[model samples]
Target: MTGNGGGAGPARLGWLDALRGVAALVVVFDHSSATLLADFRRELMPEFNTSRFGIMVFFLVSGYIVPASLERRGCVRTFWIGRVFRVYPLWAVVVATVLGLGLCGVVEIRDFGGQSAVTVAVAHVTMLQELLGTPSLLLVLWTLSYEMAFYLLVVALFTVRLHRRSATIAVTLAVLAAASVAAGAALPASALSDRVGTGPLILVGASVMVVAICCASATSPVLRLFGGVLGALPALVLVPFNGTVPLWEGLVILAVMFLGTAVHRAEHGQGTWWRAAGTAVVVVGCAVGSAYRYGDGELFTRRGWIAAFLAAVLTFGAGLAWRRRQLPLPLTGLGTISYSVYLVHPVLLAVIDGTVGRARRDDPALEAAFFAVLLPLCVLTHRWVEVPGQAWGRRLASGPRRKPVGGPERPLLPFRRPCERTRRWYP
Candidate 1:
C-alpha cells in the first residue's frame, strides 16, 4: 500500500476491495438462506462458508497492507496503534449493541452468561476471542482472532531486525515450521487431543511460508521461482475445494494468505491478469463449493454442469471488470467496511431469525428479501456507528497533530514528523 518514492500515500488494491465486497455478499447470501436452504446455510454453511474465504482475503490483505502501512509511517508503535484502533473500537460497539439488543428483547441471546460476557469482553478487547475460543456475541469473529495473530507475527518480524535480513527470517521460520511438523508427528495422544490441537503446527507452517515469500522477493534464481509458485499455490489448492471440506477449508485459508502476499509484491498497476485469475478462481470456487455442498456428487450431472456454468459466468464477469479497470463502488465500500460488516451482520441476522422471521424455511424469495433488508441495515450500522467509533479510536491511538479524515473524524497510527532526510533515506 505504500510508495517509497516522494512520500506518496499508500494505494488501495482495487481487486482486494472487490474480493472483500464479494466475500461479504456471499456470507450474506449464506446467512439469508439459513431460512430457506436449511441443508445448506444452517446445517452446513460452515462446511461451505465462503465467509471464511472472505476472512482469508481480509487477513491476507491485512498482513500485506498493514506492513505496507508500517513502511509508509516507518514505525511499529504507530502501526500497532492504528491496527488496534481500526479493529477493536468498532468491535466494542458491536458487542454492546448485540448484548443490548438481546437484553432488551430486540434480539435473542444464546448461552448468555457472566463467563460468556466476561470472556468475550476480555478476549475481544484483546482481539483474542477467536484464538482463545468462540465469540460470545457473533459467530464470525474467529477469523479476526487468527488475523490478530498474523499481525502480532508481523510486528515481531519487523521488530527483530528480521525485515532488514529477510534470509535470516526465512531460515528461522523454515526451521521452526519443520520442527513444528515433526513435533506434531511426535506429540503424545494427550497433546494431540482437540483441546490441544494443531494450532502450533499450523502457525509454524504459516510462518515459514511468509519468510520464504519475503526472502524470495529480496533474492532471485531458485528460491524466487519456488517462492513465486508458493505465492498462490495455497490458494489454487483450496479455492475450488470439495470433499471432506473442513480439512480443505484450513488449507484454503493458507492458500489465500499466500495469494495475498503475491498480490502485495505485485507492482502498482501491474498484473491485471493475476487479479483476473485470482478473482475468477474465487468466484468459481464458491460456485463449485455450493454445488458440492448441496448438489449431487457427479460432476458430469446436470447440477454439476450448472455449477460450472455459474462459476464460469462469475469468472467472465470478474475478468471483464478487471480488464476494464471498472470496479463496483458499493462492493468496494463493503470490502472496506467488510471485516466489521462480516463480524456484526451475522448477529443482526441471528436477531432477525429469532424475531417475527422465525427462521422461515419454505420461501427462498422471502429469505433472500430478508437479506436484502438486513445487509443494508448492517451497512447503515457500519456507516453511522462503527465508522465513527473507529474514527474516535484511531484519534486516541494517533493523538493530536494528525488531520481528521472528516471534520469530526479522527486519525489512527500517528506519526512523528518525517524530516526530508528520513524520506531520502528510505527512497
Candidate 2:
C-alpha cells in the first residue's frame, strides 16, 4: 500500500511513513525468513504470523489515507486517474520483470495451474486475479486483490454519500464475518470459479469492472451512481465466495479497513470518538472471535492470528496518537520506498531462491545481507519509478487549464483546504 501521499519530500505524515516502513520491513522479513532464517521461522511463525501482521498494518494505512486522497480531489475521474498511475506503472514493471526473469530462467514463476495464458493475463490485468481463481505470478500480489476491492467499495460509498457512515459499515461487515462463521458458510476457495469456470468468471468480472469504472468516471450523475453500485457488486460477490482466504477473514479484512475510516472520521470531527471506539471494539472482537472459531489454518495458529490482529490495531492507534511527533528521516525514507519494497522483494527473493537456492540453515548473516541488498534497490525503484509516476498522476488529476463547459467538476463535499494551523490533521 501507498504511504500518505505521492511525493517523497519532507513527509508531513511522518508517523504514517514510519508505520509503513516498519510494516514493509516486517513483511520483507516474513518472506526472507523462508530462505534465510528457516530455523527461527519455525519457532516464530506459530507464535506470530509476520505476513499477516505486516499486511494488516498496510491495509490500515491504506484505509486511512486512500479515501482522504479521493475526497481531497473531489472527482471520481481524477481519483481513478490518480489511483491508476499510482498503482499500475510499478505493477506493470514488476510483472514484466518477473515474466522476463522466468523466460530467462532466472526465476521460476508460480504455476498458473490449468489456466491459459490469455486468462492469466486478463485476470492479472484486472488486479483481481487472486479473487478470480488465477494464481498470482507473484505470491505477494494476493493482498492487492483485497486492496482493489476496498477501492471499489470506497468509491461506491462515496458516490452514494454514505461515506460518513464508516462506523455502521465497519460494524456491519464485522458482524457479517462473525455470522458467516456461526452459520458454517464454509465455501472452498474459488467456489464460484469451480462452478462457473474460471474463464467465464474472469471475463464477466473484468467486463463489469470496466463498465463500473467508465460509468463512474462519466460526467452524468445517473451513470456515476449506477457505475458505483455496479462496481461494488463484484467485490461484494467475489470477496465472500471466491477469495483464496476463508470467507470470514475476507469480510474481516474489509471491516478492518472501514474501522480505519471510522478513526479518520473521528479525528477530523466528521464523526465521534465514542463511535469510532465502539466500532473498533466490535471489529476487533468479531475478528478475533471469528478467527478463533475458524480454528488454525495450515500455516497459522488461531492464537497467532489473534495476536497479530490486535497488534496491528494497537500499532495503528499508537501511530495516530503520536502523529504530531517528528520521526527519523531514515524511517520515513524507508516508508517512502515501502511499496517498492513490498513488490520488489518477492522478485529479488525469487531470483535468489532460483539461483543461489535457499539457505541450508538459519543464517542471520544472510538475512542481513539480503536487507542490505534489498533496501538500496528499493530506494532506487522508489525514486525512479514511483516518484515520476505519481508526479504524472498529480499533474493529470489536476487537469487541463481550460475548464469544460459543465463548469468545475462536482466536489465530493465542500472542503476548505486546511489552514496552516490545521495542516497536520490533513497529513
Give me the candidate number with maximum lDDT: 2
Worst 10 residues of 1 by lDDT: 1-10
Q: Give the runs in model 1 whose Cα sits over 4 Å from its true position.
A: 1-12, 39-49, 112-117, 134-136, 164-255, 268-324, 357-360, 397-427
Write down the lDDT of every candidate, Cα atoms only: 0.47, 0.86
Backbone clash pairs for candidate 2 read: none
Model 1: per-residue Cα lDDT at residue 84: 54
lDDT of 2 by residue, 1-427 (tens): 7556433245457888888998999999999999989889988887888999999999988887788767775567777888888888889999999999999999997887879999999999999999999999898899999999999998888888787788999899999999999888989999999999999999999999999999987766788889999999989999999999999999999999899888888988889999999999999999998998898333255877888888999999998988878888898888889999999999999999999999997889899999999999998888899889888987776654543345554433344222121121110
